[model samples]
Target: MEFKEVVGRRRSIRFFEPDKPVEREKIQVILETARLASCAVNAHWLRAIVVDRDKIPPDKLNQLKTPVAALTLDLAPVHIYFFCDLGVVKRIKGSRLRELVDAGALAPTHGWSHKFVDEFVYPQILEPMTNNLQGYLAAAMADCGGAAQNALLAAFDEGLGACLNTPNPVLTKQVFDVPDDWVSLWVMLVGYPAESWEAGGQRPRPPFEELYYEGDINTPFKRDPGVVEKLKASKMITAPAPLPGRRQEILQLAERLNLPM
Candidate 1:
């Protein structure tokens, strides 16, 4: 699919074909895409634990599900638990940055060098950030969000359905044997969709002007209707959600799956 179409088609798929297993290669592709996402300081804070739902003992799986995500957790064949490793910056100590310098990605023209990293970046900047744990976590988690979004987009591109869910963090840590330094983020529940790919239609968002600004706080970025039309033609802007027969579709799905109406 074209990139615009892929972006347009992405939906937080809630009902999945529980019995259908996602292919190993597709899962690897998702992870690979996430691995290639941009990160600050080359720290690469994002980490994931991929779990096969069928392989998990039923009791443990139950423990992992939160009140809101129980149905989603049960329906998805694969659960990818994402994390931001807080210790990565401290452990690597700017070695990854030095690697970028050595490879010329971080050029001398940008004032990047191993000596610069060791002297100024690590000791002065990175170390102090690490000392302020709350600030450090916020920054690292933002990087993880980018990587997670890549994984989500990859799932759609691979003809799969996925949703980001809040897992039971305490149970997740215990069941997955997560590292002490790792902070739990969302669990991406993935599988083949039981419903149509459109799932109704594109979900709603705030008005574009309300969300963005031009130069000043008072100046809203005026949206161009011509560009909007071009995007709509390219399928980037699609029909809004609660599409016709959406309720009937949900009812049928519920009846077929023996779920509450």
Candidate 2:
């Protein structure tokens, strides 16, 4: 699809053909797209559970309806749980390590090495109580968000419709039996859109001038008229190009994930 068309068509698809099954291969394709999403210093910490009948909680599944709308979860062919893992940041080189080791600041040692891990890092990270809880949570949340958006757009590219939502986090934790260390960030329903009534036209977006900034938020950036016109005229609404090797990387990752039985 053209970029503009994809943008115009990519709506928060709520109504779907409930009976139809979204193929495993297609779902794989969407996930592959998400795998390519950008991250902060490649702190890849998001984990997703593509739940079908067996793993999904019965009671929670029964209550998955919105107030006025139809049962959104039941309508889709598949439901996905997006989770944020707190450990990824701990494994990577992040700001916390930098702050501790920078020359001016209180340094952990001469350099960040395995020796440092044995002396300073091991005692600090191994003890569950001593971890940087807040810092880890913040990094994990950001990583999860990037992965979520990747999944959403990948669905769009696959000619599938999807709705992303935040389910009751507490209930989700209990129902899915998620570990205390991992948090449920959100859920997304995926399937082909039902051909029914129009979901009132595409929602509004603040004119680019309002939302975007130049060097800072204080100064509104002016996009070139020709460039804007070209974008507006040609294709779907897209962000910038993702980093190279994203799709390939994600496909390799899918092999490691637990797919529905």
Candidate 3:
């Protein structure tokens, strides 16, 4: 599938064909894409548990879901639990910078050594993340989001439906035999689509002019109309008009779910 189409069609798929199984090989490929996601200095402090519907006991799977996630998890063919591997930050040089050095992007004489990482990076970055719990949690969530999005796009490329979600963190962690440091981040529900794969028409977004800054906070930056038009024409960018009744439909669904509108 085209990259633009993949972006457009990538919706938070809720309904899935429960009985349909996503192949293990396909899951491996999606995970490879996830491994390639950018993170903090390529610390690679992340891992995942790819749970199949039939493999886990029903009671345990139920524990992983909250009120918001139950419907989605109930029907998903697979549930991928993304988490932070606290030990990665303990490494003197994380996987990424070493790989960069090996690729000749860094001169051996120019960059700091693993000893420097031990002396400085740990004291300045990793230590604070632990001593300051909020910082640690925020970094974990952001890192997992980056990795999960890569997997989601890869799943889309494989013609499978995937959705990113946050389940009840405590319950989810309990279900898996995670270490004290292996903190739960979020989940990605995967399977064959049970509904239309279309984007449900273009969704609403903040006005483009309001989204970005020109220099500082005061001035809003607008994209050049000619460039924007060209991108739209090539199907690389789209901002379709909203369909009528969409907001009301959303409100109804929220009401059904007992969620604040």
Candidate 4:
């Protein structure tokens, strides 16, 4: 599929084919594409754990209610958890001197030690500016979003359905044996979508004039009608999916997708 259609057609598909299983390699490809996303300090702050339908014990899946309102934990066959690797920032900071030298930013001829960064540079300059515990994890949350977005796109491209989920961190930790240092951010539910992958003609977006700004914050940018038409024709922008019937279908399936009481 064209990248434009892939993005435009992507939906938070909650209903998946219950009998179908996702290929192991497809999950890997989606994750690998996600890991390439850029983040703070080149630290690669995100790490992921892929849990197939079988990996997580049945009792563990039962502990989830919504994870987010309306998300059914067991509906999708695969769950990919995007988490903060707490040690990433420190690892990046510790390797700073060596990386700088290798990149030719600093000369090996310069008298630099861990003490230089540890005592002088880090304390006065780097420490205040760089990762503190609260700040580091906070930044990681932002970093993980990019990686997650990549995963979404990758899953769509691979003809899989996926949704981002907020699972209960406490229950998740118990289920996955998550390390104390790792933060459970969000999970991606991946599997075969039950409905049409085509746009459902329901795009809940603000008007472009309301969404985009001009030279000043107070001013809205007026988009040209011709340009908008051109974009629509090119699949660069999607029209609302064919409607009327679409909403009911989504609602009905959404109800069915919910876990049994």
lDDT of 1 by residue, 1-261 (tens): 888988988999999999988999999999999999999999999999999999999999988989899998999999999988999988999999999999899999989899999999999999899999889999999999999999999999999999998777777888888899988889999999999988998999999999899998789999999999998999888988989989999999998877886
> TM-score, each model?
0.98, 0.69, 0.82, 0.80
lDDT (tens digit, per residue) of candidate 4 on 165-201: 7878787767778778788788788999886675375
CA-lDDT, candidates in order: 0.93, 0.66, 0.76, 0.73
1-261 per-residue lDDT for model 2 (tens digits): 654666655777766766677889988987786777766534566778787633456677865544533256766778888888666555654544444444444343445644564565555654342276776677668777878887887787778898888877676777778778778777788888763212344556778889889999899989688886677567544333243554554454334332221
Top-lDDT structure, candidate number: 1
Model 4 misplacement above 4 A? 67-71, 94-134, 247-261
Candidate with the greatest TM-score versus the true structure = 1
Local error of candidate 3 at 200, Å?
A: 1.6
RMSD of each: 0.8, 11.4, 4.5, 4.2
Candidate order, lDDT descending: 1, 3, 4, 2
Q: Is candidate 1 or candidate 3 better by lDDT?
A: 1
Give the least accurate 10-residue stretch of model 1, judged by summed lDDT. 165-174
Clashes of 3: 0
The alpha-carbon deviation from the true structure for residue 204 of candidate 3, after best TM-score superposition, in angstroms, is 1.7
Each candidate's clash count: 0, 4, 0, 5
